[model samples]
Target: MKYYKLGIVALSSSLVLGGIAPIAYAETSIPTNVLAAKTTTSEVMDKERLIERVHELFPGMFEDVREEEFRFDSGRSYGEESELESYGLRFFKELSSDMYVSGRFSFVGENLELVYYSYNNENNEEALFPPQVSKEDAEKIAVSFLNRMTNGSDYQLADNDDELYFYDNQTLTEPVEYNFRFDKVVNDVPVPDQSIRIEVLGSGVVSYYFNELTGKQEVFEKKESLLTESEALDRLKEASNVELQYQIQYERSDDVKAVLTYLPSPKIDGIHGMTGQYYIAGELLDKLPKKEKLKVLSSTPVEKTASITKKEAKEMAEQLLMPKNDFVKLNIEGVNERENYRGQRVYDVEFMYETRNGGSGSSIEIDVDTGELIDYRGGFDERFLGEEDSSRPLAYKNALNKAVDYVEKYASSYVHEVAYPNESDNRQNRYDSDDEEYRFYFPRVKDGTIVNGNGIRVSIAGDGELLGFSIDFDQISDWPSLSEVVSKEEALKDYKDVLQTELQYVSNNNQNEYQANHYKLIYTGEMDKEVLRKYYDAQTGEWTAASSRYDSGKQPSDVTIEHPWAEEELNFMIQAGIIEVENPETFNPDAVITKGDALKVLSKSLSRYYRYERYDYEEQKRQTFKNIDTDHDLYGMIELAIDRGVLEADTENFPLDETITREELAVWYGRILKLTNVADHYEIYKLNMKDSEQVEKANVGYVALVGALEIMTPNEDGYYLPDEEVTLAQLALSNMRLAQEMAEMDIDYR
Candidate 1:
């Protein structure tokens, strides 16, 4: 996030060398009229006008404060030139006890549109800190702050909101910060990605505030939903699935343990407004077009399977730095051989250097089969930046020349092809340095199309020395010679054909706890991991597959069960198909539930469709539990529970068939609540029973949770009867209650 690139001259020149070309269509597919309407600019505001607007916004906050205006780097670009303009301001105030606070703000134009603002206390002394404020007080402060920024506009508070986080210490000595987020509403519905956040400290002081609003609000098209909420939910549910998977419990050991459970399917945040259907979001890619594949090559190799020895890799790495005289004595740090992500065997070689001046070394990857360079990177010794005899900073052109020479000398035997630099990746560093740092990124192209992940990035310091360099060549042996078969117009048509605009209840996660549905265009094309989808591929006239869908578990066929008391509960579970009985015709409600059966139900209830990595348990069974072996029907679930710390019975004597005690069941359910992050709200209720003392102290949390939820009730004697065995019917009812609670609370199990 360094602001190094400033000069338009250098930025434009580098873009030309980077091989970027103008495209006919908008990359994001946003209509040209929409784009134009959003870019409307106003006349520039003077410093006096900006100051007046600030004073009007806040009546007394700016009194006697030192204020200044300076150029700010607005990180944005349009066409071939930089479109960033700065109208920034800074204000500083010294408090009563000599502790100082500072505030920074940015304005867009004559109307004084505030884009960014932040305030922080400079002193760390505890005595000077302000008094701790309640959550309500913080909300009031946030409202005042937002009201002033928006010039009398108002916002709403989200439910289960007012997040409070403590830093430094949990004790009274540390300060707690409360974050308040508000959204701008249009036609009684919240706008997407347009909101303001006001963070208040314990002192009720506004610490940070940002209004992420852009585009002309007046031009926004507002509409109503064409589909109901139930329809959208159904679509997502049909396409999505919850899976069970084992992850190492990071809170404890690094050793393999299948303790944690997670869902593989991505959940929908809300439905889109325009497209009244369920849609995923791209928070990652935004609306960029998805490339089919990245073309990566290291020239035409002499052989398809040429072997590269460790010694050869070391030598090739050293050659990349030959042109630079800074590296004096170099030693091979380490060399490792492994298959890369593309299934190509490669050698990773690291080299450290004793510089003649003050530079560092290189880490390079070489393709083992073709003896070609995959990537090379090295860091510069920063001490050289301050030295009097350090090399003079090179001009932008000279730096590009050096970078090209380095790549040509060490990368490949074929002519180096330069792909255009990605607009998002292009930036100039401008902080903590004497000169501007220019960065250039170029994809290695073959057969016209730039490969997806194959590229070279070179950064040149103001001193003309290489700041850093990197190259990614996947060693693609063959590439399609001709461009995509489909025409650009055809691809555009395809994109529109598959695009879906849905009425979704979008929550910016700031305001509107009761999310209102908004119409938004959703790409119906293939999505990757989340909601963001890939754009239609011009060559194929089809949207690229974001990723292949996974198969969750399937349910068993319907069966009749006759246990009257547990009939409803059993049927519900059977419909969910997470837990199944061997004999579907009868569910023995009065049967004593064994530890193995209980755990199997719990594990499957949480994550039924999840695939688990099976391990040989012959040794574990012989050394610990004899009742459950590797061949046991419920071995996977029981073992998973044991590894996850849900059950911690004596390993040597696992009573798989023995009826589980009520106390033990409480401990198991308690562990589940903790693992699933269902808050333990157990302190409010008091148990008034003589047998309460019989409940083990370790199982108290579990008992309290179940009791509070009425999942477990006392007997006529008002006794919990902690050690008594529970029947299958009772456990099923409790499990059902807990499942319902999880859904209602919206607790994330994955």
Candidate 2:
């Protein structure tokens, strides 16, 4: 089995295993209470002092340490003094054993703090698989470590919705790591923006920690002066508004359902606890404007076909992104045709510019069918220009007009389906004095209701220049009718049923500034019980979580919780997002497994490309089987299996729904192991089973190979059961073993 190395090191310098660099610490002395003190002035520490501070944090971990100089600047010329020079100090050390540790220190106020640290060891062979420590135990370790830090008592553990045992490129051999985030609290209310994250390995070891709490002192609104919870809830109700939207819901089947749901308007985010006012775009408001009416860009829909050539698309991109200045030279790097998520074929044009100092580049996309510009983002750096503009920035209204004009000129063909957003729909603080750019979204309207997730986003710079533009239009043929939907008032009542609030100290300050100017006491919607946040079905007038609609097929069945045989493997597959069952609540482990379903699980285990896409199969180009066309739900997985050589496409049609046999599964595993040639020569293999004669002549080698590899085993009677129907539980255990064997052999199907 392959073990994954897990560690995080924050440094620009490379790591080299060697002895410690001798440094004299007698010249510079740091205060013992420096780390715990909250000083006002900035303090610069020497190399020796920084090393001493690191040792204090993780005592005896960095005995053989080496110091390295790490410097950085904000687009400034070389040889200039920068703030990073005083704060960013890196150190590395290799222990006498196979363990290695590295850490960095930064000056937070006048105190030196360890900003980042990583500990890794080569002898991870004994690391327990599936994690020995549970999430509950890991949380205890994280909280204990946090409480040991200065002012850590002021923080509370925040809710984490991430999977408990999953990691990127995770294998069964790697130990599990649990990550937690703790938010700082003021007056018993959480400051959502201020948080410290900690990651604990399954071995009860704190592998990583990050403290985002700034050194700058913050002032918060007095909690005593805040309005009561009931008053705040009433204010929220008055400010809240609900709208009808048609959402495309992708299920485990091929058919896509259009869900008409009552979704809350994105206008009101929170209610000020002290003033009983609505907070929109970080600004309090007495009332919100009326919802905007649909304003279609054109009366007729544009022609949708792949009519534009690569040369034509490149020319269009050059016309839009290439600046009309002679000071810089722009070159077209390449152009490629690709299908987008929405099943729209488009041309991606890549280009770059050369300036005297340096160069930057960006790409744009154009719909191949309509020959209309779909996306573009362009901005020239001011430093590369000749002189700075003396004129003032464009007003919000003027910048918006510029964006509208550009969209009308470039993407006019496809604009008929989208409607301009309401003035109140601009979720940003447009009235703010420091606001720079204006972002606008034109949502797709159908049957006089917005299609919540489909829209076009356009961004306009403060100087009235087109900064970015992108169009997202799904090929939706059927839209649910709104005639039988519940009344808006009834839907609003249903929304209020599950609506809950929590007090939080919110900050509207710029993120670049470490210190917040001030924090406001606000009551924000907190639906802690519901995973879907806030969504009400218009037809049923019932609240629903996103899992009910999208993840019903992926959720583990209750019956698999304590099964005698396949519970652990089935649960692992579900947690890893490898297998999908039709009815998760009542998944029958003993049911005969379908050929297509078994192939999907095998492909997902071996191939990285076997991913579930809502609209991916609609645009799939390969059809490995006559029955499994682009319209089939598992078309992509079948094609991926064919590509990986696990499934042969020699047959005209695949029996997707047919019951798979044990011997058939063995053949697929043989192909996955790249032993198909040896399996074909059945005479060269010997079968040591009591029912060896029952196995087919052509499948004897495959059955023998799997039994030898221990991916599959015979019964206690020494019968291979080659002709038996493969059950869900049997397949789950075999797939797990197959994955482990593939990892051991270093076979990467990806």
* Cα-based lDDT for every prediction: 0.50, 0.65
Badly placed stretches (over 4 Å) of model 1 are 1-45, 67-86, 91-100, 124-131, 152-154, 159-174, 215-221, 241-249, 252-750
In candidate 1, what are the lDDT values of residues 613-654, reduced to their tens digit? 234443233323567665555666566666656766566767
What TM-score does prediction 1 earn?
0.36
* Model 1 residue 186 distance off true place after TM-score fit, in angstroms: 2.4
Query: What's the TM-score of every candidate structure?
Result: 0.36, 0.79
Model 1: per-residue Cα lDDT at residue 31: 19
Supply candidate 1's per-residue lDDT for 364. 73
401-495 in candidate 2: lDDT tens per residue? 77678767667765677776567754632422233467777777776677876777787766776767887665667776798899999888777
